[model samples]
Target: MTTTSYRTAEQIGHTEQGPRPLPALGVQTAASQPSLVDTVLPNGLRVIAVRKESVPMVELRLRIPFAGMDRLHAARAEVLANVLLTGTERRDRAQFDTDLAAVGGDLSSVVDPERLSIGGSALASGMDVLLDVLADALTGAVYRDEEVARESERLVERITMARSQPSVIAREALQKHRYGDHPFTKEMPEAAEIGEVTPEQVRALHKAAVLPRGALLVLVGDIDPDGAVAAVGGALAGWQSDASAVSLPKLPDLTPGDVRLVHRAGAVQSQIRLSAQALPRTDPGYAALQVANLVFGGYFSSRLVENIREDKGYTYGAHSYFEFTKDNATVLVEADTASGVTPAAFWETRYELGRLVLSPPSESEVDNARQYAIGSLLTSTSSQAGLCATLVALGAVGLSYEWLRDQPMRIADVTAEQVAEAAEKHFAPSRFTGIVVGDADVLAPQFRAIGGVVLP
Candidate 1:
């Protein structure tokens, strides 16, 4: 047997299909350019406006950093987000929808884990009217008790449906197992908790989470930045609240050698997820780890896909990622395979991980992976909506366009040594936490042969 060293980089050269040409970093393509102007309001609402002359329509996204509702005030934030569109003081539900439809405009809202977003699109000519209506709905929503009860029932039904799905069950189980007692484990409230949500609770939550200080407004398409700010500011001027600062609990330390399995009967395919604690977005290693994950399992031609899908044909697809965030982060590998082939798939995943840890990727592999990452970044910025969304997400993460403008160089600068070092640090097999959802009798023996198994 040939002794393979994991420390040395492999000698694989560029494939028959050579590297794709990198788009010139300073290429003046119309599609790659963004016309965004940033400003701040007196009350501290940050506005990002992008001018798109081709489209006659406009899209506006309002992001309120009231994610606190899900943790400290769960029911209240949820109900307020839902009730905002139900009706407002100036317009009832019917009139609201009618006015929007008359101008071919539509409004929608969602309360995410970290923010409440209200978004809509309309003809550029009707932007002022659309902004007014959206403003009224957000700042003057009437959370009537009857509406709250009705919405609560709807939420309960939705939660019940989510529980019925096996994939969701496995995902939720993984979150609970990984996070343990952390608030991230608590998704939707229990039915009893939903039943106890009162109108007063919704009001208080609205007061705390919907304040202007913790909000971001992104507008795209034909619109004047100054005019748009004035309109939005005028609408939200009356919205006042003594909302407190958002404080997040320290993330829990993830223990290695923790394995969790959830068995679901009558399942045709097994959902396997293995993860490890990882670095946050602020880490200097983020860019390098991104390249490592790409070569590992993030792309179609990645190592995981090449090993599990192309070489072995055990699963449809397998991939891994690092969820880079400010307070918490995790690296995960997920895939679904046939019940009979689950064991083989799991071991193959482990084997590939071990290979990456032992042997660094070849120079050509590193170049290809870097090129793919940079290409994707350019593609994402090609669309107006995608561009605006990227800006909004960067802002949320405390980054700016200047940072994004420098990403191409950063990705290109990543070397084979850096990718190898990142793999060794983040993808160590000994630190892995595996979660498999399948028939235990068939899977347990194989898992036990590989690593210890914890069943639930």
Candidate 2:
């Protein structure tokens, strides 16, 4: 038998000097602009249709501004989303699934504090069927008592489980600390509140908040753009209301303060959440800020990960990302570590945040971040589903396909100096405040020694 000789994995991965240098990122190029139509129906629903023929399937996303100010709105809204597709006047739950499955389609609805979203997919040949089913639910969901009761019980159980998680506990503490009692902070409602949401309340909410006006519908796939818009308009003609959907009230501005140390009794692990106000996507400074953010901690290779995770072994992972809501945006840095390492991780996180502001990024670092920002954007939109989701997000902020088509050029245009300026202006240590959730008994001494944390 003849055997082929081969190098071991370690041998192939290194050179005499050290590990091999990574190849420089290639010249970034823009994707070809897709054929598209964007128009508002007479009933005030904006329809965006883009023809992406990569696959013989279509993806759909519908977003309605579903914000409400009442204290119990979250609970009611969650129930509504859970049962929205359970039954319509035209079809019950079984029939609804049967009809969509017959056309190789499925749809799901979810709600957050800001909006109610419906997403679905189907073979391109069954696009019409998908739209029909969506329309049937939007215009005719009955909110049957049995369906409401069933979903409520299930939702309460889920909420109970989720609230027990350390991450959920940390997030709740952060939101409340940042924006006290704001409707937007109530992302997950109380289980007791969910248990009390009656079917009549859900129906009332649907009738009042599920209006077509001010909502957006996006469709991307192997279909004619113009024809898709026409189909949507025809199918949803009955999903009309004289009033527009409810938008969340503007969020209160965040202020810098001492980080709150929240006590989670009996917890052995800890969550550190840090946040600071940042520019929105619509801001002219956003591109430069985006690059700076990537360099700081937005990706696995970022400085925070390299420092706290790779070097110090303080946490398994660390990340920083922007959270956008309505017209406001904020950057959040997060890490989870054992109770013993939590204080060290928090200190290093704060150090890195300040370092980005004072030291800024080197020219080489800025270039790498720029390449990553542009490349990730291109990769995210390379598929039909991705493009559809992107359009929905951009549309919510009043941007269109043209904005997306030109985003690469925008990222590429950012200079190192611009990125540095953004870093200094936005990422100062004094600008951030957040929470650390852990066994305070274990963390209080170290955190107090560190001097910026407000212990419970």
Candidate 3:
């Protein structure tokens, strides 16, 4: 028997090692794309529809822009979003759940800092019924006091559980540090705050903030474009639009400073978050920055993951990304490592930051990131739910559908230099705010040696 070891091509009798060919570049030209259709109903409601007949199900997303800094109305929006799903005028909670289960459908509502979204999925055969239920819940919810109380208790439980989780605590602290004094940074309402909410307040907020003018209806599935539009338009025709305009508040300035850390005793691992203010979706730099972010830490093969996880084994995983919004944007780097290795992980993170700033990405690196982003977009848009969600989000921020469709091309065209420039501009080490949630006593001296460490 002969024993043989695997060897490189050069050692295996090849004359020489050859460079591989680069991936196919510039496949997507600017001209070949479909545009988004926009229509307005007689009742001042805006409807944006994208017709993709590949799926048997339809996804509908309705968003009403009523988010605010007012503690009272903000709490009301949250309570209303939950209670509306609990029961409606025609069905009790149990009956509602049964009906949805019978049809293999799901309904969800969420209140974020910018808007309240009510969305659901149902088969084409059940579209009319689902639409009717959604309209009834949005336009005629009872907001019963008992339901509110029950949901408030549930929320309190959720908040309590979230506080005990290191990841959640780190995220909340990062948001506070990023948006100090802004509504986005407002502390989570306590149990007492939840108890103070009244049914009347919820009703008032629904009437004022959930109007048709600020609302957008997005439907994607196996349905007729004209008929679906008319159906949704007629259902919401009676709701009044707010004639008085609402504008999003300007983003607060980010004061650049040293690393900030939050200490948590008894935590076996440290959760680190570093972030800086970023550009909104409308910025031309948005596409380039996204490409840069991927190279830095946006994916498994990113620099952060390669250096911090693969090379050094400092943490389980490391990643970074940019969150785009109408009023503000943020870029974040996150990781979790054993308390003993927290300092080493932080130093490696800093090194990656410095290295990316010092040298821009190579053309091949930029192309790979661009291809990944574009491929992701193409794959996600193939789903009815994904397409509908994208349409709704774009409309909510006053962006056209054409813009969404053209995103892949724009991403493909981003140059390597642009990505590097974006990195240098958006990620300045001196401006980063870091939050560490772990055993402070064990990790403090190491953390302080790296830079600034802020205890909770």
Best prediction by TM-score: 2
| Local distance difference test, each candidate | 0.75, 0.92, 0.76
Residue 274 in model 2: lDDT: 94
lDDT of 3 by residue, 137-210 (tens): 76777788899889988977876776677887887777777776567654465546777888888877777677
Question: Per-candidate TM vs. native?
Answer: 0.86, 0.96, 0.89
Best-matching candidate per lDDT? 2
As for candidate 2, its clashing pairs are none
Query: Can you tell me which runs of candidate 2 are displaced by over 4 Å?
Result: 1-22
Residues 176-286, candidate 1: write the lDDT tens digits.
878775655555555557777788878766666677775678888777766767777787677665553353355675677856767887777899889888776557887
- Model 2 per-residue lDDT tens digits across residues 247-290: 99888879998999999888889999999999988899999999
Q: How many Å off is the CA of 305 in candidate 2? A: 0.4
Give the better candidate number (1 or 2) by TM-score: 2
